[model samples]
Target: MKQVILDRIRAALADRPGPVAVPREYRRDLGGTDIVELFAERAADYRATVTRVSTVDIAGAVAGALRDRGARRIVVPAGFPDAWLAGADVEPLRDDPPLSYAALDAADGVVSGCAVAIALTGTIILDAGPAQGRRALTLLPDYHLCVVRTDQIVGSVPEALSRLDPTRPQTWISGPSATSDIELNRVEGVHGPRTLDILIL
Candidate 1:
C-alpha cells in the first residue's frame, strides 16, 4: 500500500511542468541597451501612454496631462514625491480611506510611484508603500500618472519577481484597466484607471 502511494505521488509530481530557469547573468546585463525605448515600445503595445522626461520637466508634463484630462482634483498617495506635482494647478487629495469612492471617481486623476517595471510585459508593480496607497485609490480614479525611475525598468518577469518581497502587498498594472465580452470588442476602465500614463524619470 505504501509503495502504491509513493508511486502515485511520484506520478503527480512528474505530471507537473518543470520549474522555469533564468540565467543569472541576464539579470545583471539588462542595462546594456536603451531600456527606456524598450519600456516605451512595450507600454505603447499595451495601450498605455509612455513619456520620457528629465526630472526638471516631469512636474510640468504631469500637470499638463492632468489639465488635458480636465481633471481639477488630483488624488495623491500619502508617500508620493512632492516634486512630481510641484506648482500643479489641480487640487491634491491625499489617500485617506474615508475619501469616498464617488468623490474619488469624480476626481481628475491619481499620481504615484511604481515599485518595479517589467520591460518584457510592459507591467508596473506597486507595493502599498508610502507613495503607493491602497488598491482602491488607483482603481477608482479615471486617470493615473505613475512615476517610474529609469533604473527600475527590468528586462523580464523573472528579473522583476526576483526583486520583489512577497510579504508586501502588491498590485501589478499593465496598461489601462480593460475587458471585453461576447463579441470580442474591448472596453477600457472596467476595474481600474481608464487612462494610464507612465512617466519614466
Candidate 2:
C-alpha cells in the first residue's frame, strides 16, 4: 500500500515542467540598481537587522552594537578581519579551541566575515575561511555579526557562484536559523543564532 501511494504521488508531478526559465533577452536587460538598497531590502525580508555604514566607522559601530546589547564576551573566528572588532572590548572567544555545545551556548555573540552575499536572495555565503571559522562557531552563538562589503554583493546567483571556489566548504545563511513541524508554525534558533546583525560597508 505504501509503495502504491508513493508511486501515485510521483506520477502526479512527473508531467509538470521544471521551474520557469527566463529568456535570454530578458536576462540581457537585467538592469542593475543600488546594491546597498537591494541588500537592505532583501535582508529585511529575511528577518535580519541590516545596518549601512562607511568603512571607517566599522569598529566603533560594531563595538557600540555589542555593548548596547549587553554582550560580555564574544567569539571571533580566527581569520576575521581585524578592523571589524578593534573597538569592541568584550573578551575575544577564539575559534581555535574545540567548540562544545555548552561553550557556544554560553557565549554572548559571534563575529565573522563572509565569502560573498547574494543581493537577490539576501543570503550570505561563508567559505569556512579564517573569518568564518568552523561551522560550529557561527552555529552556537546566540547573536551573529556578519560583515560584508559592497564589492562582495553579487547581483545574481550565477555571479556569486563565479567568485566562490567550489572546492572549499561553504555555509549559506539566509537569516536566523529556523524550522517548523507538521503544524506549519514557525520557530527560530532551532539550530543557530537567534539574532543576526548584518553590517554592510
Candidate 3:
C-alpha cells in the first residue's frame, strides 16, 4: 500500500506546471536619503545606539563608546585595526585561537568591523572578515561595539547579500540580543550582546 501511494504522489507532481520567474524589479531607491543616516535611524528603532563620526576621529569615537560603557577589557579579532583602539584605554584581548566561553563572558565587550550593513532592515552582517572574529566572538560578549564604514551601508537586504560571500560563515544582527519569550516579557542578552553600539564612519 505504501508503494502504491508513493507512485500516485510522483505522478501527481509530474502533472504540475513549471515554476514561474520572479520579478526582479523592486524598491531599490534610497529616496534621496543618505544610506548611512538611514541605517542609523533604522538601528535606533531597534534600540541600538549609533554615533556618527569622521574617519579621522573613529579611534576617538571607539574609545568614547567603551569608556561610557565602563568596559575595561575588550576582545577583538585578529588583524583588527590597531589604530581604531589606539584611543581607547581598555585592555585589548586579541582572539588568536578564539577565547573560551568563560573568558568571553568575563570580558566587558567586543569590538569589530562589520562586513556589511543594511539600511532598510538595520542589520549588520559579519563574515569573519578583517576585524570580525569567529562566530563566537560576537555571540558570547555582553556588549558589542561595531564599526561600520559609510561605504558598507546598503539600501536593502538584497544589496547587502550581493556584497557578502555565501560560503563564509555569516552572523546577521538586527539589534541587541533579545526575546519576548516567557509571558511575553522582553529580556535582553539572552543569546548575544545586550548592548550594541554602532560607530558610523
| Candidate 3: residue pairs that collide | none
Superposed Cα deviation of residue 3, candidate 3 (Å): 13
Candidate 1 stretches with Cα past 4 Å from truth are 1-31, 96-98
- Highest TM-score: give the candidate number: 3
Higher-scoring candidate on TM-score, 1 or 3: 3
- Which residue pairs in candidate 2 have backbone atoms (N, alpha carbon, C) closer than 3 angstroms, thus clashing? none
lDDT by residue (124-201, candidate 2, tens digit) is 999988688888888888899999888888777777888999998889999898888848888876768889989888
Q: What is the lDDT of candidate 1?
A: 0.84
Ranked candidates, highest TM-score first: 3, 1, 2
What overall lDDT, based on C-alpha atoms, would model 3 receive against the true structure?
A: 0.89
User: How close is every model to the real structure, measured as TM-score?
Assistant: 0.82, 0.81, 0.90
- Expressed as tens digits, the lDDT of each residue in 47-111 for candidate 1 is 99888989899889888778777887888999887888885788889866568888788887888
Query: Which 10-residue window in model 3 sums to the lowest lDDT?
Result: 27-36
Estimate, for each residue in 1-201, the C-alpha lDDT of model 3 and write its tens digit.
999999998898897877789998887657777888889999988889999999799989999999999998899888679999889999888776657889998999999999999998899999998889788888888999999988999989878878999999999999898888879998766878999999888
What number of clashing residue pairs does each candidate have, in the order they appear? 0, 0, 0
Residues forming the 10-long window of minimal summed lDDT in candidate 2: 23-32
Model 2 reaches what TM-score against the true structure? 0.81
Model 1 error, position 64 (Å): 1.0
